[model samples]
Target chain A: MHFNNEELGQLEDRYRAKLINSLSGFKSANLIGTTDGKGNHNLAIVSSVFHIGANPPLVGMIMRPHTVTRDTLENILELGEYTINQVNADIWKQSHQTSARYEQLVSEFTEAGLTPEWLDGVKAPFVAESRLKYSLLLRESQTLEINGTVLVIGEINNVLVEDDVIANDGYIDIEALETVAVSGLDSYHVTNRLGRLSYAKPDKKPDVID
Target chain B: MHFNNEELGQLEDRYRAKLINSLSGFKSANLIGTTDGKGNHNLAIVSSVFHIGANPPLVGMIMRPHTVTRDTLENILELGEYTINQVNADIWKQSHQTSARYEQLVSEFTEAGLTPEWLDGVKAPFVAESRLKYSLLLRESQTLEINGTVLVIGEINNVLVEDDVIANDGYIDIEALETVAVSGLDSYHVTNRLGRLSYAKPDKKPDVID
Candidate 1:
């Protein structure tokens, strides 16, 4: 529809909830600690994590702005690292709560009622419950002033998916992931894997025009 | 299905092909450009725009490494201003092709056979073909070293939707907008308005729960 700034002010929050609850139907994830450096350790549930490119294996994420202090922003700026920890339905609520304002000393893992683990070299924490925790290094971070959010780009250094999550050739099963997407705020959803379209190899014949 | 990095490495190209080619239906968009200083004119297509937050209305995009000189990045770095032009199915191809490495002096609108417009006080050129466009300012820019990509973040300042495409309360109809989407490489798709959802208001249920 249409909205003036004052009317559309809730756009981000609305979209966030829609994305999490409606569009995303497979899994949720947590924004963990910094990667290569010791910046900050923060936690929040994000339904947005999709690749932008494959040659370089690039991934994109939407980091909503902080109403208060943003630990993830501070940490990533200082340490230059982050881990995207895949969240199943079980930990979605707990992970989502990490959005709460907490002191630097407080760990979201404790507050979220979850455990934060570590990989040998990466600085970002891993959700102990995750079957696939990607230890990615922050290659770039940008803030879009229009939306008052931060888009963090990460180069994957290590993918710590449990053996069970993959097929022989790296195919990931949506069912196994059991990931949920957030639609509106607390609403959650799971989607059917509509057969994947073969984008790389165009599959249709050119239609004849009259 | 599951895949290991090693396996993903072998089939990465194939999956990429499928992934990109599969983008036959989705919301396609263009990133209008402006100088960070005095608002130099720039226009480029962007399928990478993504939200990073709700409260701040943050969004981000992955810019291919500077191998190709991009005025948009320059503007974002220099003046920190940009606009996202949402492309419909009608102009999706033209918008997508703006990624071709063209001369810095060459106007993409001219090269691609499109018109560039301006709005608000921003100097960036907008795609006349877009159904909706949002003017924004660069809040931050982070270069991703791991993937050799740059992430640009922008906050939305003003949004412009073609009168016909918007609903009364700020709903932008995708089906009506005829928005398209993109994938890995050469892929294009028009999106359908699957449904709508509302944000979490604490006092109310999300609009999309049904």
Candidate 2:
């Protein structure tokens, strides 16, 4: 099936959204944890987290239009700090529940039956059940005028992880952590390692590592 | 374990890069296909594709600093179009090979053992071995001065998919298509659907859809 621009535009609005959303395939699943000035916690499931740079340890997330009233965006902007917790199979349901549109005063942590724990000095809370998590200090944010969306980039401040999850090479063992992958808007997935290939070289075939 | 910002900065370079890369979890795996004005083909494996908006069907990809000389970025900018093909189990090894540094005039499609197919009126070619592919028209390019990276936004102009891969509600069945997910730089993954939940609501629990 081939859908050209005209045909794609003709698709029913909802259907086109679904098709486009899932077209990119599996996305990172993380719960963005934040707290308002009064220390009320908020958690939202985000799939757009992508590495921006390694030296500065920066990560970027795309927030939808500001017209949507995003609490996570608000908290990150106001508090200048937050935490990103990898969502694993053990708590995917609770993580998904965080997407619900509760009132301004409500905390998704409490509403979704997930516990929030703060690092001694970090302002934001981490999802207590998450095995791998990191607190981030807001670095820079730029609103994309083309679509009215904001790209929030954050600098890593602290990382908290279970001892066994980190490999000797610094590769986080995500499969072993059971961190879920997401597709479309509502689907969650569990991933099995197919293989890890050696760094590519022009003259040599890649060797798959154990 | 907790690694503060200062400690993260002091870690070994490769270790820090790997740790920061894996922090984001699974990313969308695709072969970015492009054609130069001279009709030369290019394919490169990319994991940065992320959904930006569905109204105009926009997708964004982060291109490393152009100082490194990226062929896909060059071709997309010169030709004004490109294709994104979902990487799957059948071609994961070939796809990973696309990451190797070939000569300036080399076609990774041939070097990586993948077939390139053309669609009418689309300048760029899609990966013939891929079950899901989409071509896009260059809409915008913005350089992030903070890190010297470029964010390339494209409007999805056309999509070619396997007949049965699209569901009734317009969701692309990535699992059925065998689309693979990627972690860090070289790890490949096969996914199993855990489940899909209903649209979230504040007062009601999300009903898990079978």
Candidate 3:
């Protein structure tokens, strides 16, 4: 099938959303955990998280304008802190539940039946069911001019994970943790390893590292 | 195990890169195809692609600062057009090879042994082997102040995909097309879908859609 710009724009609203969302291929399934600073906790499943840099350990995610996600954006800006929890197969249903529009005072942790745990120095709560998670400090927030979506960049303040998941060279074996990937809006998937390739070099084809 | 910011900063650079990159979980594996408008085509495998919005069909990807990706960035800025091809298992090795730093005039398509084909009215070349691909017109480019990385936003000009892969509700069955996902910088993966859940509502638990 071929769809040009005008043809794509003519697609039905929800249909276009699913078609365009899946065009990015597989996405990271994470739950952004934040609080209003007065005990009201918020958790929303987001597939937009992407790695920004390694030296400063930055992470970036997109927040859609005029949605339930506004709570998450506001909390991060107000408190300068948030937690990103990887949604595994075990807790994906609960994580998806967090997307429902709940009142500002209602905590998604309770509504979704997930426990909120606190780290030693982090202000935001972490999903106890999430085996791989981290705390982030808000670094920057910018609204794209073409669209109202907000780009939220954060610095990784700390990482929490199991020791067994880390390989010798610091590659986290996410498949071992069963970290899921999201496609479209609601589909969840678990990945199988296809072997790691060596660093690309101009003179040779990449070799399987293992 | 937990690593605070200070400890994370002190780790070896390459090790930190692997760790930090993997923290974002599974990412979309895409081959960004661009040209200098003088027939010098460039192809680079990127895992940073993420969906920005649906109304305008916007897609965003990050370009690392001072890297081989400079070729891809320069080409997009000059021509205002590029193609995003979903990397599948059959051509993943070839796609990874595009990361190698080649001379300004060297075409990665020739080096990696993949064929580039162009569609009507789109200047950017598309991977002939890519079952699901799309052409994008550059809409915005912003250099992130926190990091020197550039965020490239583009509007979807056209999409080319197999008809069978699209479902009734407009969800593209990428698993059927065998589009792969990336972990860390080198590992590739194929996914097994768990299930698609229904949209969340405050009154009830989400149901399995299929």
- Ranking of all predicted structures according to DockQ, beginning with the best and ending with the worst: 3, 2, 1
CAPRI quality of model 1: incorrect
Q: Candidate 2, residues A97-177: lDDT per residue as tens digits? A: 888878878999998999999888899999999998999999888888778889999999899888787878888888899
lDDT of 1 by residue, B110-209 (tens): 6666787767576566677776676666776766666666777666666666567434443334445655444323434443222344432323333442
> For model 2, which pairs clash?
none
Model 2, runs deviating above 4 Å: A66-69, B66-69
Worst 10 residues of 2 chain B by lDDT: B64-73
| lDDT by candidate, in order shown | 0.53, 0.89, 0.94
Q: Which parts of model 1 have CA positions greater than 4 angstroms off?
A: A1-47, A50-56, A63-210, B9-28, B35-41, B54-56, B164-169, B197-210
Question: By TM-score, is 1 or 3 better?
Answer: 3
lDDT of 3 at A146: 94
Candidate numbers, best TM-score first, in rank order: 3, 2, 1
> DockQ of candidate 2?
0.85
lDDT by residue for model 1 (A60-149), tens: 666655643366667766777677776565655565566566666666667767777876766678788866567666677766555556
Candidate whose lDDT is highest: 3
